[model samples]
Target: MDAADAMAYLFSPQGRVDPYPAYERLRAHGPVVEIAPGLYVATGYAAIDEVLRDPRYEVTHEELTQHPVAGWAESPAVASLTGSMLRANPPDHGRMRQLVAGAFTPRRVAAMRDVVTAQATALVAEMARRGRDGATLDVMDEFAYPLPIGVICALLGVPEADREAFRGWTVDFAAVLEPEISDAELAVADRGAVALRDYFRDLVEARRRAPADDLTTALVQAHDAEAGRLTGDELLANLVILLAAGFETTTNLLGNGLVVLLRHPRHAAALRDDPALAGEYVEELLRIDSPVQVTSRKATVPVTPGGVPVPAGGRVLLLLGAGNRDPERFAEPSRFDPTRPHNQPLSFGGGPHYCLGAALARLEAQVAFPLLLRELPGLALAGEPRHRTRLTLRGYATLPVTVDADQHHRVVVPVPAGERGTPTGAGSGTP
Candidate 1:
């Protein structure tokens, strides 16, 4: 397909399912190519890196979205999301980000290691139990989604029983996040956003009434700090953002990583034997097939990315997935090599707005993958994998997998007595 056709197809429902070939074609046009009148796409790694590190580029704020749906400004969800640190620029972004960073501390993440491992162990056990009779199981529903959800809920002080309710609400809320949205999808997003906003508001009030030792309580304390560091809308919006992001991306990571493992059983065995290798494996896994594929930015003034001019207010869709696979950046980019040296993917973005939950997300995958392979020795894809129909957040909706206790791959090795135990899963983020 030509550049225009490629861009159009990338966002189409069918093309969105697998946009790798289109990405390769876009890069052939140049690092940054104008796909539409005022919209450009950055496919090359260097181009994306430069645009990300440049202060001239800013996140596409609500004003730049140009959503023609009536009453978009009145949307509580949109208002909350846009007001949050994620999309805000400069002073406001810095302020809210500081407060959030203070609450979401490194110590908090360190403490979750035990919680994550326990959760992963239990979930893997449940998967083994359910599929012991040779029954097919949706790993996305049973394993991938639950691990991160359980972890984030625990971190936020949410009740365990209330975990399942978020599945539909988050799914509905994610509609507005797509590259394009229909009026019907907008309506669904609005309703879901309203529900989420109210839920967080109620939770905040409860935390205020009786403080607890969780991220929510920590944020509540931060919000109550002197000088009014975080506004009420900022608090609610970030709460929704945190909850939504905490599990969604990790769910994708787990699902995507599992597919990679099942496809290449040797790597799974390597990780199972020496769990420490998970860090390297996860990095490669993300580089080859990232969880979050696209993010947008608008030029505040005339600027150029990869020597391509972008007028003021011009929008650029950064194809992160494409950048990860750029042949210029990676030798035989299509090949998945876990032992690659000096490997770093633009999966989480760069500069001031880098994903705060990045380290935590890596830790979760690192810990979860080893145990998953060891525990479910005969796990295999039972049916065709079904992907979530969106380019922004690329992942599987239903990964049909079966645990074959009898048929074992040569790669499934027995772990040492001292090295064996239930594993873990936890964390959240954008990429």
Candidate 2:
């Protein structure tokens, strides 16, 4: 297919299954291709990297608000989403990022290592119990979903009991990120946004009254009257942002990583042999198939990406998945090599708006993957893994697998009294 066809396929349902070939086709056409009126897609690594890190490129929040589509601008989900750093620009973005920066410091993330280990261990132990003797289990629900959610909820001081309800709210909240969400989905998204906003409001008030040693408490108690750093609206919006973005990235990372390992049995065995290589293996897995596929930025002034000038306010869709596998940047880009040198993928993005919780996501994957491999050595796919119908966020909706510890390590553990059986539904990703 030609460039236009490839670009079209990249956004199509079939493309979501595997977009790498389409990406290569588009990149061969040009570094930057105008897919539609005032809409460009950057295919190559250098062009995408430049566009993402350039100061002249801005977020599309203002344009979105001015030109509402699907009536999302009037929806509560859009309101909550646009109020945070993801869509913010300039002074507001800087201020909002600074306020939460303290809570996600290296020291803070490092301190959560034990927590991540314990959670991963508990989940794996439970999965072992459920899937013993080759019994089938959905890895996405039992292991990948709960590990990150539990960690994020604990950090945010969200009550453990309410996480089940949060899963439904988060799925709707995340629909706001879709490029073409239907009216029916918009209604669900609005309800979720309003519910999430109100929930955080009560939580914020509670934290203010009874300060605790958690990120929520830190945010609620944090104030500089002289500097005027945090406002009530900003606080609520950011709290919602944290709740979604915090867990979403890691959840997809864990799910995607496991799928890759399953496909490459040799690599899985290697990782199981040496768990310390998880850091490298996770990076390669992220590059081979990014969790967040596409992100956009508007031109604040005339700027040229790949020598193609984009006028002010023109939107540029940065195909992060394409850039990650660009031949110019990565040799044999399609091959999944954990030992690939100089592997700098744009999975977490770059520049001013780089993901704030990147380190935490990395930490989660590093801790969880090894634990999973070591505990379930005979783990293998039981059926076809199903992908979620989303372009922005890519992950498995269901990862059915069976564990046979007859030849490998055996983990026969009893499930806790309160958490014995499987959850009812598949989990969702936010942000």
Candidate 3:
């Protein structure tokens, strides 16, 4: 396919299913290619990296509003989205980010390791119970989806019962991020935006009344030494961003990682033998099939990403999925190699707009992968996996897998005298 055809395919259902072949075509064209009259796409590693880190390339509310969907101008989704740090620039972005940064500290994220492990283990055990008779378990719905939601909701002080409701709300709100959503989808997203805002308003009010050690309380009560506190809208909007971002990406990560491991049983066994390799394995999984496929930035002034001029105010969709697979940056980019050296995939982006929850997301994946593999040794795909109909977030909506309690009984060493409990579902693998 020609560069134009390849770029066009990205918006088509076929391309959404698997865009790597199209990415190769675009890369073959050049570092960057003008996909449309005013829009461009960056496919090369160095080119995408430069664009992500470039100060001249930025996200702005004004740019996001341009050529928006049919009813987006007056939609509540637009109102909430426009106030978020995701679309802001300069002073506003810097100030809000600083407030959030204080709460999402490394120490705070590291504290969730035990929480993640416990949640994953419980889910795997539940799967074993349901699948004991050789029934297929929908791992995505039962395991992958709930882990991050439980973790993030707990961290944000959101009640356990409300987490499921938020899942539906997030699914609706996600349509706002798409490029060509319909009027009907916009209406659904509008209602979702309103519902989310109302829910957060009450939560923020409660936090104000009596603050706690959770991130929500920190954000609600945060005060900059000079910049003052976040406005009502700012606080509410960012809370929504945190809630949505906190879980959505990590959910995809867990699902995608499991799919890869199931495809390569040796790697799964390696991780089962020694869970320490999870950190490295997670990184490679992210590089090969990133949860977030693309992000856009606008040119503030006339500039060039790959020696091709982009007029001021023009938009460039940075193909992060394509960039991660650029042969120039990674040898045998398509191959999944866990032990790869100096692997710096732009999965979380870079520069000022980098994802604030990156560390937390990484932590969850690192903790969850090991638990799933160790707890379910015979975990294998039971049916055809179904990917979500989403262009940006690539993940399975349903992953059917069967687990064998007996298969998980493989032991490398003699079980300790007192440590050997009945291998009902926990199995004898203690690694």
Deviation of model 1 at 106, angstroms: 3.8
What shift in Å separates residue 154 of candidate 3 from its native position after superposition? 1.3
Q: Which run of 10 residues does model 3 get worst, by summed lDDT? A: 419-428
Residue-level lDDT of model 2, residues 359-404, one tens digit each, is 9999999998888889987787777778887777778888888877
Question: Each prediction's TM-score against the native?
Answer: 0.91, 0.90, 0.90
- Which portions of model 3 miss their true places by more than 4 Å? 62-68, 223-228, 405-431
Top TM-score hit: 1
Candidate 3 positional error at 287, Å: 0.5
> What global local distance difference test value does model 1 have?
0.80
Give the per-residue lDDT digits (tens) of candidate 1, residues 192-284.
Answer: 888888888899999999999888887888888755788788888988888888888888889987886776656677787888888888998
- Give per-residue lDDT, candidate 2, residue 169: 86
How big is the RMSD of model 3? 7.6
Could you give the candidate ranking by TM-score, starting with the highest? 1, 2, 3
| Candidate 3 structure lDDT | 0.79
User: What are the Cα lDDT values of the candidates?
Assistant: 0.80, 0.80, 0.79
lDDT of 3 at 218: 83
- Candidate 2 collision pairs: none
